[model samples]
Target chain A: MYQFTIKPLFGTEEWELGSTGVNIAFTNSALWMMITTIVVIAFVQMGTKQQMIPGRWQVAVESLTSFIDNLVQSSIGAQGRKYIPYVFTLFIFILFGNLLGLLPLGVLGVHPFTFTSHFTVTGVLAVISFSIVLLVGFWKHGFKFFTLFVPHGTPIFMAPLIAVVEFISFMVRPFSLALRLFVAMMAGHILLEVLASFVVSGGLAGLGFGAIVSLPSMLLMIVICALELLVAGIQAYVFALLTALYINDAENLH
Target chain B: MPQISQLAETFSSQIVWLLVFFAITYFIVGRGMVPRVMDTMDRRSKQIADDISAAHAAREQADKEEEAWRARENENRARAQALISEAKAEAAAKSEKKIAAAQKRLDKKLEEADERIAASRNDALEEIETVATDATQDIVARLAGIKVAKPAAKSAVKESLANG
Candidate 1:
């Protein structure tokens, strides 16, 4: 579908900055990102009435806010409060991104884009989370932050080998985080696209073929659609949880 | 896939928008709204704590008052018991004194009456003796012309009465 296609809505689809190059053109991905941002802002704003007794909308917003609040608090301990805005931003942004992609806006001829399905997008988020961890670790513990690689009770003889392996594993955090979300979202969308193509192809073939292939594909697509919805929320949660966990390691050096 | 093949073209826009939007969410939701909600929760918890402490104080006060009332009730009961015993002792002593005085007066009256009765008995005896002597003298004189002295007759009558 053209929904996944990156077409420049403003400038030429080319990077031509001074040296490193930057694609300054606004695209469908940026549009969806903007939309999700607006939605997040509005949702949060709706809950900020500061009423002693909250209404339904306020409850909905407060639940999400407190969900992240609790997540950070549990994962990062007392230091978690400082990073709530960051972790919350990552969580709600990705969550809204994933859900917005699955909207039935295609029926109205306005196909929704899932920016989080892109490696560039997920990688950026992962990098941001990783950067925060690095900054917090260094600022709090200096070079001693490197001790995060070695387990507390490791034997001195096995320290170097264990340290190397731990170092590699530690370095893989951002890539794994980016890849998990990107692949999960991309795969589900791709499967839906393939199934949709099959439905169309089967319908064009014949009535019997449509019954055999299109009907089952349609049913399967429905099931997969439901599965994808679950995956969307799960992927967002996993991303946020992993980010918080990584931050925990930096904060507590464990 | 355009995601990989066209990454160069779209990466910058995506990253830029992500940063921009994430900043917006961070400022609006995290900084603006969350503190207010937390404050409300804190205020509610504080109110509940204050109410609980006040209720505890009131319960404690009620208990103290009840204990005082019980102590007062016990004191009054003891005082009433003492008063009842004292009144009983006083009444018993008054009644005993009245009985003792009545018994003494009865004994005195019995003694006086016994004396009076003895005197009357003696007078009657004298009269009888005199009469007996006179009759004896008259009879003797009439029958054999013999006369007896009054004192001798009386002594003889008294001796006979005493012997009888």
Candidate 2:
């Protein structure tokens, strides 16, 4: 099925600028990302008038901003206010990226691409957030930042074991964050694609039994799409919320 | 497996696009939209606070004005009451003087009437005494056929009258 393949929209062509090994290519993922950026920028620009009594668009933007602000403030304390921009950017990008894929572009024979469906994009975001946590930790606490690994009330004998466990847990945070988003998005889309293929194949193959089978499949697809929308929002929120929590741990060492 | 291997092939381009788009969103949202929203919220709250305080001030002013008006009305009422009482007292005093003057004149008239009635009674008694003396004298002359002296008769009459 065409839905199962991740083909480059531009026919696998790479624009090699120089010997520096930087490939500038127009991929589907890049196109979707650019669209996401444009959409976000347009939404922000729509609310630029900033009315005291806000209209619908301004209210939407302000609510999202305040939601993220409160999340950051509650999770990471007042010092986390500075990271709101980064967290907000990550949240909106992932949120729209997930939602954009759910749009009915397959009807037009164009498969929608969600940037978050790939591990590489999410991995980059996770790495950025994880790096911020580590850098802020070490910068604020110096070499004692490693103390974050050891449990506070542990016996000296068990301290070494706990530290190793804690270190491993810390190192796996980025991968887990990346995989959680990537897997959820990819799984939901694939399920939708498979169900859609079944509906199409059944509809084309027969007149009575096959068409009746396609009805339930279509209904199930609808239900799954609705669920995917919720998953999209929740996943974005979870990603930002976890990032804030990690930053809090880094700052507070608990 | 294909998906896993796809990472190496698409990693660079994805990273490039991610960085570019993310930076743009970050700048546009962070630098542009956020501050405007915050400003709108702050301004709205400030406007509400100002409205409430102004309403309170206006209410207080109205209360003070009403209180002052009530005080002035009470003072005016008290002054009117005082004027009414003063007029009542003055009328009472004038009536009392008139009654006193009328009482004094009535007393003088009562004394003059008493003196005149006493004088009249004395005059009537003297006339009756003369008439009785003459009548006694006449009776003695006619019935006894004897001539009596006037002074004697008078003395006899006075003795009889006194004894009776």
Candidate 3:
């Protein structure tokens, strides 16, 4: 019997990943992300055409394109248009990764909820999103984006203290962006997988006397699946929205 | 900060797959896919705008044609009204010519009748003068019991005048 858990296959390993002291171990999260990127590239490329009006594939791409356009406009204003493509890509990639993870192949090959494993996929995605935020900020504002930490109308007497707070706030940008995405994915996956494991246990337990336990587990799996879909959409939206805001802040030279 | 260290000590195993996944997405979509999609969308939007402009031009041309048709219709109607007025004047002129010709003919006939009446009146006056003279002479001769001859009277008046 296979179990679902958030742990790496090589729990105790060390590796040198081209001067970045990263352990080299493959996980399902890595596989899913690879799939997501390939999907995005192919989806965009194949959808491209020379027609005035969009066909089905192009229309599908436009749907996301317009959604991101509106999202950026409402959240960050017109300056957000420049960031739309990147944000849309981020949103779709995260969404698909989360959704596809819910499928049969997402967390397979490894046992569920094992003690030796930890969810590292969320961390890597977090790093990427954070890196983008940092890079985009720097590219747009140079060093002016640092002023984001210092809220307007602060007292001159507390300048040093305010500066320290600003530094801390600036430093936390990556962490915050990364953590928000990582937490949602990690929590949703864990909760759903745990409930699913219980469903199996309950099914085994039910002979006719344990009907009540199995019934609740079955109902719970359905609920979790529904919630998983919502979480996936929300996480993707949050990631894209935050990235756009970061771009907006930088663009405004705030 | 405490939670971080605790997590670091507890489970550092799942970090490797995260890096691999991030790397793949960043390279594929960020570098390759996004540009293609954006380029296509931009091109499509421009093409749609051009199509919209063309449609607008076509609509404007149709409107202009409709306006021209309306103008021509109005012109034709005006020409018809003017022609109708000219025809009415021509009809009045024709009727006026006939009426004037008939009036002139009637006046000429009336003038001829008046001339004939005047001639008859003069003839009657001459006859009446001759009759009155004969009656007067007859009456005088009867009253005097003798007739005076006009030749003798005239000769007597002339003899008197010569002797004087």
Highest DockQ scorer? 1
How good is the docking of model 2, by CAPRI class?
acceptable
Every prediction's TM-score for the first chain? 0.95, 0.93, 0.76
- Model 1: DockQ score: 0.43
lDDT of 2 by residue, B1-164 (tens): 33566666767788888888888888887666677766776687799999999999999999999999999999999999999999999999999999999999999999998999999998887787788878877999899977788788888887887898
The residue pairs found clashing in candidate 2 are: none
The estimated TM-scores of all candidates read 0.75, 0.78, 0.68
lDDT (Cα, tens digit) per residue for candidate 3, span A195-222: 7677678778766634666678778878
lDDT of 1 by residue, A1-254 (tens): 45578877776645446566676677888888889988988887777787767888878877887888889899989878878777877888899999999998989999899998899889989999999999989999999999988899999999999999999998999999999999999999999999999999999999999999999999999999999999998999999999999999999998
Where is model 1 more than 4 Å wrong at Cα? A13-21, A203-207, B56-164
TM-score of chain A of 3: 0.76
Query: lDDT at A12 for candidate 2?
Result: 56
Instruction: Put down candidate 2 lDDT per residue, A1-254, tens digits, no spaces.
Output: 24434556673555655666667576888888889988988887776676878889988888888898899999999888788888888898899989987889878987778888888889999999999999999999999999998978989999999999999999999999999998998889889888988898988888784668788999999999999999999999999999999999888887
Off by over 4 Å in 2: A9-14, A20-22, A205-207, A210-212, B49-164
Residue A113 alpha-carbon offset, candidate 2, angstroms: 0.8
For candidate 1, lDDT tens digit of each residue in B28-129? 777777777666666766888999999999999999999999999999999999999999999999999999999999999999999999999999988887
In the range B44-121, model 3's lDDT, one tens digit per residue, is 778889999999999999999999999999999999999999999999999999999999999999999999999999
Q: Which 10 consecutive residues of model 1 chain A have the lowest summed lDDT?
A: A11-20
